[model samples]
Target: MQHDEFIIQVSNRAPLSSRDHAELATRATLETLAEPLAGGEPFNASAQLPRGIAEYLRHQYAESGERFSLDEFFGRISQREGVELPDAVHHARVVIEVLSEAISSGEINDICSQLPSGLEPLFEASSQGQIRVNT
Candidate 1:
């Protein structure tokens, strides 16, 4: 999907009001999701993401190259967003759902391939009937 369309979809799916809010949410979610990957994998996987969202993941990879577990991923997002864990998970699901529609199956598969087995469910949950990753 195009950048504008991606933002509109995110805004509609999320509780955000404007494109800027949608952009912020997208960036935050992408960064949180990418935080678990090592080396340049995050940037490579983010290549198929929306432009603004991809930049955020690339920036995180360049700046810190931090790695964490799936639990820590949601924890950090919850803390940063000042929401509870369930809320953070819901936000993640929404973003991943949008991403599943925006990017190609190959791209999604590539991203999931880099993630550990435990993390795959997080993305797959959003995909629902569309993408199913065997655990």
Candidate 2:
């Protein structure tokens, strides 16, 4: 699939629009860090990429009732991608920290805060759709 299409697939699966963006950003960052994770790489001993994310979020909601620690969130993702997750995890954490500080300092809601609205929704829709139908 093309990059845009891949992003769309990612969106559909995300539980919330914001979470989808974070997830996609993390994936893109990971892909850029090394090589894009090979398709169909076994994420862990059993789970695939989508499954890992779903499990992570499910645990998050079950435990904290809110997302915490981009490091933890994306760390699980990197593992699922079958890569050493720390580089991506650190990068993602930096981005989050910067964004959090910016939001505290200013009024940026979106992480990038410049992209078109509904873009994240599209991603969540596309990603979740693909996972349920294809995977």
Candidate 3:
């Protein structure tokens, strides 16, 4: 997907009319996701994304993943996104759902390899065809 399309998906999925909000959600989620990604997984995964949106995934991280729990991960995303934890969690799911569609399975799997099973709910729902109705 192109950058606009990717942002649109994030916007619509997040149900936010603000274009900047969409960009922020996308940016924050991706940037935070990069922290725990080690080796070349982040770069390889970025390769599959749109060039504009890809920058968020590239960051100088540790040789190994930055160890943290799923809650702490969302907390960082929450702070970076400037939203509440609940909103951050929701935005994360939206951004990741869009990301799954935007990239190849192998690339996503490689990204997933860096995450522990506990964080699976963030992205696996889309892959498993699990519909989440947050009402």
Best by lDDT: 3
For each candidate, give its TM-score against the true structure.
0.76, 0.25, 0.87
Name the candidate that leads on TM-score: 3
lDDT of each: 0.68, 0.33, 0.80
Go through the candidates in order and give the C-alpha RMSD of each one to the true structure: 3.4, 16.1, 2.8
Write model 2 residue lDDT over 42-106, tens digit each, in one string. Answer: 12211312443323322212322233343444555566544467544543443333222222212
Q: Candidate 3 overall Cα lDDT vs. reference?
A: 0.80
Consecutive 10-residue window with the lowest summed lDDT within model 2: 37-46
TM-score winner, 1 or 2: 1
Among residues 3 or more apart in sequence or in different chains, the pairs in candidate 1 whose N, CA or C atoms overlap within 3 Å are: none
lDDT pick, better of 2 and 3: 3
- In model 3, which residue pairs have backbone atoms overlapping below 3 Å? none
Model 3 Cα lDDT, one tens digit per residue, 86-131: 9998888888878888888778777778876566556554345753
Ranking by TM-score: 3, 1, 2
Distance from true location, Cα of 129 in model 1, Å: 4.1
